[model samples]
Target chain A: MKKVFVLVLISIFFLSVLSSLMGGVVNIPLKVVLEVFTGKVTGIERTIVIDVRVPRIILATLVGIALSLTGAILQSLFLNPLAEPYITGVSSGAAFGATLAFFFYLPAFPYLPLFSFLGSFLTLIMVYLMAKRNGKVNSYVLLLAGVALSAFFGALVSVLMVKSGRDLHALVFWLLGSFSGRGWSEVKLAIPLIPLLFIPMRYFRELNLFLQGEERAFELGVETEKVKKLLFFLSSLLTAIAVSVSGIIGFVGLIVPHISRLLFGPDHRRVLLASLLLGPSLMLSSDLLARVVFSPSEMPVGVVTSFFGAPFFIYLLIRRKN
Target chain B: MIKVHDVWFSYEEASVFEGLSIEIEKGEFLGVVGPNGSGKSTLLKLVSGSLKPQRGSVLLEGHEVSFLSRKEVAQRIAVVPQEYHLEFDFTVEEVVEMGRYVRGGKGEHILEELNLMPLARRSFLTLSGGEKQRVVLAQALAQEPSILLLDEPASHLDISYQLELFDLLSRLNRDGLTLICVLHDLNLALSYCKRLILLSEGSIFAAGRAEEVLTPENLGHVYGVSAELHSHFGKPFLTFFSPFEKVNEGLQIHIICGGGSGSLLIHELYHRGCRVSLGAVNTLDSDEVIGRKLSLPMAVEAPFSPISDETHKRNLELIDRAKIVILAPLPVGPGNFKNLLALEKAVYLGKEVWVVNPDFKGRDFTGRVGEIISRIKEKARFFSSEEEVLKELENWAS
Candidate 1:
């Protein structure tokens, strides 16, 4: 069953990758898209596929994988099925930092991601302190604190957007989350940070034991506090880098991991690989929907994902209740 | 092997154990039995390294448990906790495989060893309580530790499952894995553990072989109940009772019985605070055992001997002093035929006589029994069982 699901995901991933490159305002023919792969196409077609659509497709796929893997890791780390990458308030914190950078006209190329990462890292620390009682981190309290901080930071972002006069379009697009006009630079910014996932993947067995309950995991020789800390750093870093580029893409992190778990199994090793595949496919398809549904005026990819992802999540909840 | 030295442990404001010390040998199956709040579960946690004592150390294999690394400690000891509640779904195989996290495998052999092979693919949440316990036990065993700790593993199990689980543990103990189990059931502890430690007031009140430690005195004082320890097929079985209340309602009764007929009546009357006595029973008879157990005053004689002249005189005297006399159904034997004659003396004294099973005609040893029967029938009330006799006695008092 797992093998069949993997095969199907691999095929859908390739199809979504191909479809994302061919669709958009400028429709590149399938023949030219295939020819570009063979290095035979040049001129405007080459510019459209290589310079424009290719990097955008790769960025969407990368963001999807990063976010979905973050969700899977966070869910297990928190021992909560409802946990997601953005639930830690990293998305809001990063959005505020990016908006601040845009408002002050701070050098957009390098300072934007750095400020975003700093904002998320500080919020993580604050959430950590708020959730902890004495010396132990309480999972439920952490969740509540994350939500409260996210709302506070989201209000700050909105106030900054409202106060700014010139960068209104830029701020709203960043907040809505999109891969529009993204080229190799945006992909380059996220690719180097993708290896942050290696830190969490190495502790798959420890993460598996964590699902057994924290005290039981500790009894089984898992350094639970240290593992949780390291995972928080890595997952927050991954989500921060993704949001620094594409803003706050909703539900990909929340829904893709769940879909992968349902299709595969709850074992972290398998779920990690399956969600990695499924996340990109879901994101690229949503990006495709964002491109063609409005045609000339494109919808933000975040809006397109939320449009479908919210209902799918609700369906999952109702099915589970039964 | 484990040793707890001068362990002073407290939970919040209450002190559970203070200056408590114990030593356990390798390959020994030890049972910790105690009343509630006696620190039995606390002792298990201390040895498992999950709890650090406020003022002492727990040593496993000559090394302090707290000083050891997590992997090092876990490799030596495995704990089967009191409950297993996982919100996420994992198969039985997956749960058992968690034990091998430090090491690595699917833990297939451990599942097979515990007879969980057929259910390996089933969802863990779908299993029954006993099956879940077995899965947890299998997971702990997969750790391959030298020492195993269980906290009331059978407390939630039904009787058949409890026995089956203990039987499995006994087999494991025989295979030379040291076990320290906290058992709520004293009889289970007595039957399974090679040695027992009885705890009270956060200290070891008694510790030794099961038979020596589970004495009636130890149980009665620690648990605040009267009890007796009897041997059953080379094992100790405990019988418990409420403390003896001295009731002086000032009612007196005498019983005439043999062949184990009046044992229940004597025990009931003794517990109900009636001044009761028995007459002319041979020593070591089954009814005499009940009388001795309850410490009742009775006229006794040698076994296999006819009711002697002296015993008959004592029986009549007992009948003369009683307000009511009960004659339990007895076979007409030459040895005890004189017991029936005491009824005539009871009637003469104007005492109420109750004959149980009056229609049992097999006991008419005396040739002149008809005259005595008709005369006594007019004065004596007939009862079919001992319960009816006690009911009549209760009515007379009320």
Candidate 2:
């Protein structure tokens, strides 16, 4: 049953990737897209399929993998079902950092991701420090601090938007989260973070033990404090990289793992593997909807994701109560 | 083997243990018992290497536990916590497999050993309290540790499940596992653990065999209650009584009871602060159990034997000292016909003689026992129940 589910998820992911490449503005035919891949087509069709859609798809896939893996790790680390990547203020901090970069007229290539990484990492450190009582981190305090710091950084980003003159439009689009106009450079930025995903995969057993509780995990031979610190760092880094490249895509990080767990079970080994596939499939489908639903004028992919994610999340909450 | 040597530990300003030391032998079934806040759980944590003592060492197999890596410690010891709350819906087999984290294996044998194979696929969150605890125990056992530590694992279980759990633990201990369990139920502790460590206010008050460590005086001093230790089926059993405020203090009440009829009346009178005594209760009788537990001055005779003249004389002496003598609704048999004779003597002494439920319709085993009851009817006050007798006593005292 698990293998069938995995196979189905992989197929849906491939279908979503192919459809995303073919269903964008100026809707290229599948034959043309395939021919472009085979080097038999050229000019605008080739550029549209290769230069524009391919990197966007790859960036979307990487961001999807990063966010979903982050959500899965955070949920287990905090022992909270509702934990997600941005639950630690990483997305808002990255947005504030990107807004600062744009406000200062810094180039978008490397400086944006670097500043975003710094912002998210600093926010994580601050939350960790605030939540530490004695030498141990209290997950409840960490959650509260993350939420409070997220709102604070969000307010700072809004303030930066209000003061900016020429960057207002760019800030708004980035804040709403879109993968439009991104190419290989952003994919290049996210490729380094793929290793971060594998680090958490190695700790699947530790993550499984964490669902019982921290004390139980420790008694069961996990170096709980060290594992928590390492996983927290990796998840924050993944969130920062994903947010920096694609802006704040909502619910992919929050819902992908949940969907995977609902399809599979709660064992992190299968959940992480399922999330790796489902995250990209959901992102690609949501991005495809964002493009074709509005035609030449695209809706922000974040908006499209939220459109589906909010109701699905509400359904999950209601079902869990029973 | 584990040795906690002079462990000085505290949580913030509240010190839990001070200069506490205990050594447990291999293959020993030891129970850690105490009142709340006596550091039973803390001792388990220290030995498990989850908590380090400030000024002492917890040595496992002659190695300092705090210095060992978590995997090394877990390889030797497995701890079953009080409660396990899972946020995710992991199945029982997955949970038990987590026990093999330090030492990797399938742990299928552990599942079969714990009888969890039937529920292996069930979600842990959907299990009952007893089932969840059993799964946790299976998880701990999957580590294949030589020593097992439990923190009141059966506190949340039903009475039957509690016994089932301890029976399983005892079986495991008999299989050469060193079991150190912290138990809130003293009876459960006494029944299973051959040795006991009694803690009071974070210190070891007593430690030895169950009989030596769980004495009535030790239990009374630690729990602030009057306790009695009795042996049943060669196991120590404890009964406790809260020290009641003196209501009828200095009032002597003699109860002429046999069979199990006088147990409740004796308990009520004793708890009400009356100086209660018993008369001519046969050994091993149900009433005799209560009388012996309370340590009340009483006259006793061999079971099913006729009340001897010496025991009847002793019963008369007890009745003579009492300000009030009450006849319990005990059946009159030929073996205990002397009890009716003692009640007549109480009437003659001018003491307040009360007969509780004098209707002995089917209870008269001796044909002539009812005739003696008629002789004392003029002087004896009749009440329907023990409650009525106690109310009348309260009224008479005022």
- Which residue pairs show collisions in model 1? none
User: Candidate 2: TM-score?
Assistant: 0.91
- Candidate 1 lDDT over A1-322, as tens digits, reads 7788999999999999999889988888899899998999888989989988889988888889888988888777666665665666777887778878877989866777877877877777787677667444576687688789889988998888788777677668768889887898888887766677566568778878888777789778777778888887777777878888899887788788787778867888888888778989999999988889999888888898778877876675577567
Q: Assess candidate 1 and give its TM-score to the true structure.
A: 0.84
What is the alpha-carbon lDDT of model 2 when measured against the actual structure?
0.87
Summarize candidate 1's per-residue lDDT along B169-193 as a digit string, tens digits. Answer: 9999999999999988889998999
lDDT of 1 at B62: 90
The iRMS of the candidates, in order, is 1.1, 0.7
Tens-digit lDDT string for candidate 2 (B309-381): 9999999999999999999999998889999999999999999999999899999888876798799889989
How accurately is candidate 2 docked according to DockQ? Answer: 0.77
lDDT of 1: 0.83
